[model samples]
Target: MILKKIIEMKKVLVINSSARTLRSHSRKLTEVFVNHWKTTHNNSHITFRDLGTENVPHINENWIAAAFKPETERTGEEKEALKISDIYISELHQADIIVLGTPMYNWSIPSVLKAYIDQVVRVNQTWKLNPENLKNPYIGLLENKTLFVLLSRGAEGYGKGEYNEHMNFQSDYLKTVFNIMGVHNIHVVAIDGTSFDPEILKQTIQNSHQNVKSLIEKELA
Candidate 1:
């Protein structure tokens, strides 16, 4: 038998998009951030999901049909699709904070995260349209939520105004999508130059760590 305990836990959801194991730099940054966050926010609970390893199926016709079907009339198959998506959305709802361990792949987020997003972003679930104001759209499910994105890249200087900045669709796209879901505050911490000099990569990681620490301090204040 499994023991069930009840306590006030500040749920934190961490998604790994690298499709690799803990060896990935993005994963490394996420782990460090979570560890420090846990220490700072003692007694808080955390749930970690490896999106890369979750084997979440790509969205298909059946999934779409189920997601759109009215709750009262949904069939067993439809319920199953909803159940899968509910698991993801439940975590988001429970979470007080979210951390996405993302790595730039071809200047975009990984397919796994995309698949997960498809599962979670359901109409009338995470958001809904306003009939009165057809021209005005609003989403409030995840309002006031905070998100931290830890990104890694093999190349260097992908920050703003860099030659490769325009190629960085990962952070910008994430911001837009999450914003649509009503997540207002988002932070991006990048560990670039991984494929370059070892010294530079080490320094970048250290600097990011400091930045995250300061952010946490500010948030707690």
Candidate 2:
């Protein structure tokens, strides 16, 4: 019932995961996409989280133990972990649309984004294992949401060929991880070759913007 009611409000959250500042190409491209998405989804309000500069701390052994402990046995550390979990869960619960500015680093997503994921993807908050079903491992908690990831890569030819195909753990991993958290529909706009020719970079940005506009129209329709 709550899910049905909350579906009425469409909130979009844009997460900037690159450590770089305004000079970051990935952030610039994602901004363009977000602007276009705003034109179409006029009713949606955007919230931005800069995870690169404000990084989430990694979960340690104590945090892990606290997560598994019964509520009654939880110490002050567990309570703190729960507080952190609540903050992340609240953000996720409030948003209907999620957009991420992810730059490919060493063939994978930036470390900051990965850390943020670790914070948000809690066992009970995002998903739970269905013990009744032996084959089905998880039951998703959140639903009716869309995620758009704008990926920036240094080199071109990552699409189907080029030595970088196997190196694309970024998009594939995001798809798998977010899927586990119950986000079924995901759109990726991979802008490659930021280090390429200047003219090509400008053209790529323009083309990606057009692609995002088309995607927004289709999704909103």
Candidate 3:
């Protein structure tokens, strides 16, 4: 009889994209995720990247040149331009799960999070483009990576058939971006109405805790 090998604890990378450090609803929900994860998987390790404090730099001409150039032919400055990107990509590569704690800003994600994404999604490294296939030209390299997104909104009715369904660009945008990166296993938990309605905000947060708890349990189990 052959014995099946049990799965080991997973590496979790937490990316905090909230600009507000002290009083951020997204950050609060993320804490719930992290705490629950730690409790469930005692042996698992956690890596953190707080975009609120460590703002990622946007990709520039030097970065594009370095990324497109062959590894052996890159100059010192070109290599330097890619150093931060390399670090961010390295972190992404090592993680089995990624948690993004983000607050919706003006119906979309914060600029810092976009900057973070730009740094890691490198051409010929993280993904590849095939112009011949117009329908599906890009191929993502990262496989089996899962994403957990905690979104905090200012108002209510952002869900399907809700009052503000068309105004929700945050979750939809993230889904597209991660799908492009080859991550199809995505889970999103939203807590809206923090500033719009007090009662809705309270209830949403309460419901979000339950959702977050169940998500972690499912992952660990």
Candidate 4:
């Protein structure tokens, strides 16, 4: 009999960006994903980064100078400005999978999540720039990575083909951002209208778990 090797994800980076620590639906859904993932891939390691508390600072002039400068020529002060960004990019590069815990704020992702995206998506680091190639200008270096997003919405009808589809920017924005970084495999699990009623919230939780399970099975298959 021939034995088949079971491919499993090794390194996972979980970014929890909910400002509200307690009673955050996004965080709760992310926990479900992690636990379920653990059952299938027992050896998989997850690095949890809670942006609610450990929020990365926005980029400034010093950071830009360091990022544009040749790595070997960067001064001490310039390097210091890009310190956290380097760490973030390193983690992103190392992870086989990335899970994001985000709540829909004003029809889009939370500001903290946006900030995290801004810090990691760099010029020469995550991607290569060639203005000459007008057809395919920006080139991405990172590849063969997957991203899972657990989103919570206060109101319903946000997904495509839904009533308020035009207003749905949470997943769309993330897709644009990650695609630019070369990670094209992206999945989103949303719990919508959690604030509507207790029954709705309960149903959304159950449905999200089902969605996540189906996603896992499909991906790992």
Candidate 5:
């Protein structure tokens, strides 16, 4: 008798932070990634979060207090205050892979994306303070996850050792943040020089799309 092999469905979490819907190059990259990923992992479950259109609340005093408090000791009000944060953290925990697409705003990520980050980086949830080591006090909770960051910039030379590398705060900052959360397998694909001539910009975008496809194939293989 011949037996069929079973494949487990993977969970993917996709986050988009581009404010522009139609003209957003970052969004386009994410679309390409999702489409290609679906072709390979047809049974995978995908969860999408759009910070561009969604109102991601910034962390406030109440949120800070709630996150620091012990989970069992949290009051009704504190739980209410952390409702959004809990949801975001839950998604992060449930996802086997995470894909984030964002545009560079003032050499950093979009404010909405920043807000989402603030919501998820919770104390005793995503990370913990390690007093044993002062140099590295952070102990990340989430482990063995893959992350893909699709970035779009208006100008060029923001890559490593490039002319504008000194001014780049987007890619490195994101890597650091996710690394602190225990996601070590991170890949970044950037589409730069959006302000360039139309034909040049088109080619740049196509190159990024190819890069995304290649990355997906390598990762899935």
Candidate 6:
């Protein structure tokens, strides 16, 4: 008899932050990525978070106090305040790969996604602040994770050195935020010109789907 080693399955977290449901291009991108990933990683565990429909409350002063205060010393109200944040953080911690799909709203991310970001980027949880080094204070805690940013834009030319590069706040902001959380292995795929002609939009979406498939093969291989 021959002994074989069994490999553990990876955990993937998928976040969708588009306001549109049936008509959301970003959601379509995520669906494509998830389907392809499933085909490649048959046994992988996937967790889905739909910020478009689900309401992730914006962090208030109570949340700030709860997050900043020591866990042992937190009051009942403070603990309650951080309940949602804790849940979001737990999901992030368990995920080996994160897939974020969102449309560029007003040249940036949706407010709901921003709220989710605020919830997860907690001090002493996702990252730490080095007091001695003011210049380089942020120390990310969630290390060795892969992030896939699938973006949908109404207009084109948002890549590096592109015509509308300066106007792109979506990709850069997301990359920076995840980088701060210690996710260095990042892959971005954007489906641009969503507001173009029907045929052009369809082609662009197809290209993005192919790109996602290629990326999965290349990155996961």
> Candidate 4 — which residues are off by over 4 angstroms?
1-6
Candidate 6 residue runs with Cα over 4 Å from true position: 1-8
* Superior by TM-score: candidate 3 or candidate 5: 5
Tens digit of per-residue lDDT, candidate 6, span 1-221: 11111112778899999999998989998999899887776577899999999989999888888887789988898899899999999999999889999999999999999999999999989999999998878999998788999999999999999999999999999999999888999999999999888899888889999999998887754
- Candidate 4 has a TM-score of 0.93
* Candidate 5: segments with Cα more than 4 A from true spot: 1-8
lDDT of 3 by residue, 1-221 (tens): 11111223578899999989988999998899989877766577799999999958999988999999898999998899999999988888888999999999999899999998899889877788989999988887777888999999988888889999899989988888888777889999999888876776788899998899898777655
Q: What lDDT tens digits, residue by residue, belong to model 5 across residues 162-187?
A: 99999999999999999899899999
Q: How accurate locally, in lDDT, is each candidate?
A: 0.81, 0.81, 0.86, 0.86, 0.90, 0.90
What is candidate 5's CA lDDT for residue 187?
Answer: 97
Clash pairs for candidate 6: none
lDDT of 2 by residue, 1-221 (tens): 55433433578888888989878877986788677776655455778888888847887776787777777898887778667666877888788888888899988988888878888888877988889888878777879889988889988867667677887888889888888889999998888888879899889988887777788777765
- Distance from true location, Cα of 82 in model 6, Å: 0.2
Q: lDDT of candidate 3?
A: 0.86
* Structure candidate 5, residue pairs in collision: none
The C-alpha TM-scores of every prediction are 0.90, 0.89, 0.93, 0.93, 0.95, 0.94
Question: Per-residue lDDT of 1-221 in model 4, one digit per residue for the tens?
Answer: 11112445468888899999899999987888888888778567789889977857998888888889898999898999999998889989999888988999998888887888889889978898889999878877678888998899999998889998899988888888888889899998999998799887898889998998888778776
Best by TM-score: 5
Worst window of 10 by summed lDDT in candidate 3 = 1-10
Q: What ordering of candidates by TM-score runs from best to worst?
A: 5, 6, 4, 3, 1, 2
Give the lDDT of residue 41 in candidate 6: 67
Model 1 C-alpha lDDT per residue in residues 125-167, reported as the tens digit of each score: 7777777876658565776678998899889767889888878
Cα-lDDT of candidate 6: 0.90
Task: Write down the TM-score for model 5.
Answer: 0.95
